[model samples]
Target chain A: MSWAWFHKLGSPKWFFSWSKPWALPLFCFGCLSLLIGLVWGLVFAPADYQQGNSFRIIYIHVPVAMLAQSCYLALGAAGFVFLVWQMKMAPVFIKAMAPIGAVMSLVALVSGAIWGKPTWGTWWVWDARLTSVLVLFFLYMGIIALQNSLEDQVLANKAAAVISVVGLINLPVIKYSVVLLETLHQGPTFTLTKKPEMPAEMWLPLLFAVIGLYCFVAGVVLWRMQSEILMSEHRSSWVKQEVTKHGF
Target chain B: MAFNSLTEFLMMGTHGVYVWSAYGFSTLTLVWLVWNTLATRRKTRDTLRKRFLRNQAR
Candidate 1:
């Protein structure tokens, strides 16, 4: 296979132009899917045997939780490329993503806690899975804080990259914490190898929710990346022309 | 529909508090993120355009 596409992706200009066509469509898809999932899960899906109606929280909780973890993993990947190849776009990617990741982590933690109240009989716990996700939230904060604090952009990027890459160790810990350690949290609900613990009617809407949330996250990420591309390339002729073309 | 009426849907069979809060908070957060991204993009474009114009006059 050819690596030309990968190298092309490294070019901010190429990526900005290339991404223009798909971003809005993806956002619309997210909104539509979200509507479908919400209606289905709320009005159609059957209640859980144990958790009762409270299980409805899973529709948002699972998807946002996945987004939380996925964002950090993506940041680490970008951080890796930044450190190794010194890819300029990598730092922009990081800058764009950390806030979204932080927010996702926060939403996951809060919603999980709320879900816990009726199910687990408490608002918070020091369980391995929950605690690791907490750490993930802090790690995202550290990246954003570290980036903002340093006056020198290069120094800031280097430090943030180090922190992001190192924090990658926490991802696996978060994922396996329930299984490897005794915890209030449940094990995987929807895994590839095993049949879902949920029945078709219950999990089917969940599938739509998950896909919708992924699309939403992707759209927002692309939106921020586009901004980052514009900001970083403000001095370039194409950016000037591009900005003007947009009636800005 | 899972519920017999709108009131039952709202009640959520006594789990309404927990379920509604989760959905409310999450949906608000996601919407806020989208709005913020657009606002930030607009701000960046204006600042950069102003700088470009200022440089041109110099």
Candidate 2:
């Protein structure tokens, strides 16, 4: 209930100390859940009569795809924070998260391509959903490039933030593309208003995989953010003390 | 169990290649993401440590 904790999050030192204890546990839990989900989906869940075992790819595909969109939303929110409030940690979040977002998009695209081969008889499609996601990937790449290319840190952060905030226009496009357009991609598998169309046995492992991937991303973002903090704050005495204490 | 044996599970009733490749590639990438993050952290700290030592010597 206290906004004090929220304000403290803007400080790199506080965030570093707060997140240090959490990173490893989250990463471990993520890996464990992912292991369980993948194995259960592959070995225990019933195979789809339509797509057969290739449907197994859905376990990974859906989670990464979902993450791809949500991560972009995070980036946009961080950008907004950086531009409006000028929070020091906001740009760090952007820098740390951009590569992860890019990689997640890559994984989703690749996994979906692999899944498409068996189910759709094609490896690639120019459908609205697919094309928009491809643009999303490019948008992530552009943000990363913008951040790295500028020698001036302030300018780089500003430019990246601008792009990130503007790029938010695409999320809704990606979300609605399947429904709004005549596409080969299926409609939403999971929605809050109604239960998923699939049986519990099938969607349950998917649920695990989704939650696991989210935890995994959170842990990684924390790790990367800590690293970014140390690098950016290296000249500060507390950072020096941390570096000495950790002996890294 | 969805399949009768490990072999059947691996084969995935003839959809093995597609299923396995997707999992394999994505898993490798995820592993790389973790590896890269840690490596960057270590590398950053190492640079900072060396800078400290250098400053002390100076």
Candidate 3:
């Protein structure tokens, strides 16, 4: 495809119009898939012989934890786009994503703690995996705070971008911290090089949830981006015409 | 397959509290996220509408 097509993505109005058609259906599909996955994994899927029903928590914990890291990567990418191309939508995307990501991380941490209570016989641990994830959560909060605190949007994006890039140094730290610290936390259940040991019956639903959650996040982000575009482009003719056409 | 019956599943072999709490918290977070996203969109639209009217009046 032409690079010009890529450049057009920089236009907020164009993206807003483009995303409008796909948002609702994607959101609906996401919600449906999430519900199905949760029910299937929690109620129908066979539980672990060793961990018993406690392993069901994996349905939520794993997905949220994966999202927690991936969202940060997305933020970092958005920051890079903002800095390099000065995409008007980039800061808005970062703004919208930060709180969502922070909350996801919080959920991951809390769920992991809950899972830990019975499995590990403790709610809190100094284990490397747990500690590093905690740090990641804080990093997400820091980026959000930095963005909110700045008066200038451009400056705020820059500050948050720098923080996000620096924070990326921790994703690997979080992943391998268990190995480094040699703690109670188990090694990876799933890996790029190795197929997950989980049975197809269990993993299928988890995979569905992962895909659904990604779509859900995308739909939310696009919706937020549209609003941001409207806010920032209020003076532009397309936005004015859009508002008029929509009877807003 | 983990439990012999529905009762056992709910009981979770004495770890019910921890298991249920984790699921409960997960559900709450999912609900809250959906609510937050919808509310934000509505609020943004309302604010934009108000601004548009204000500009027109000016």
Q: Which is the leading candidate under DockQ? A: 2
Q: Relative to the unseen true structure, what is the C-alpha lDDT of residue A75 in candidate 1, on a scale of 0 to 100?
A: 97
What's the best-to-worst order under lDDT?
2, 1, 3
Comparing 1 and 3 on lDDT, the stronger one: 1
Clashing residue pairs for model 2: none
Q: How far out, in Å, is residue A31 in model 1?
A: 1.7
> What pairs collide in candidate 1?
none
List model 1 lDDT by residue over A1-248, tens digit each: 99998888789999998988788889889888977988899889988888989899988898889989999999999999999999888998899999999999999999999999999999999989999999999999999999999999999999999998999999999999988999999887888799997889888888898898888878888889999889878778999988866763
Give the residue spans of candidate 1 off by over 4 A: none
Q: In candidate 1, residue A31 scores what lDDT?
A: 80
Report the Cα lDDT for residue B41, model 2: 90
Q: Once model 3 is optimally superposed onto the true structure by TM-score, how far is the C-alpha of residue A65 displaced, in angstroms?
A: 0.4
Candidate 1 CAPRI grade: medium
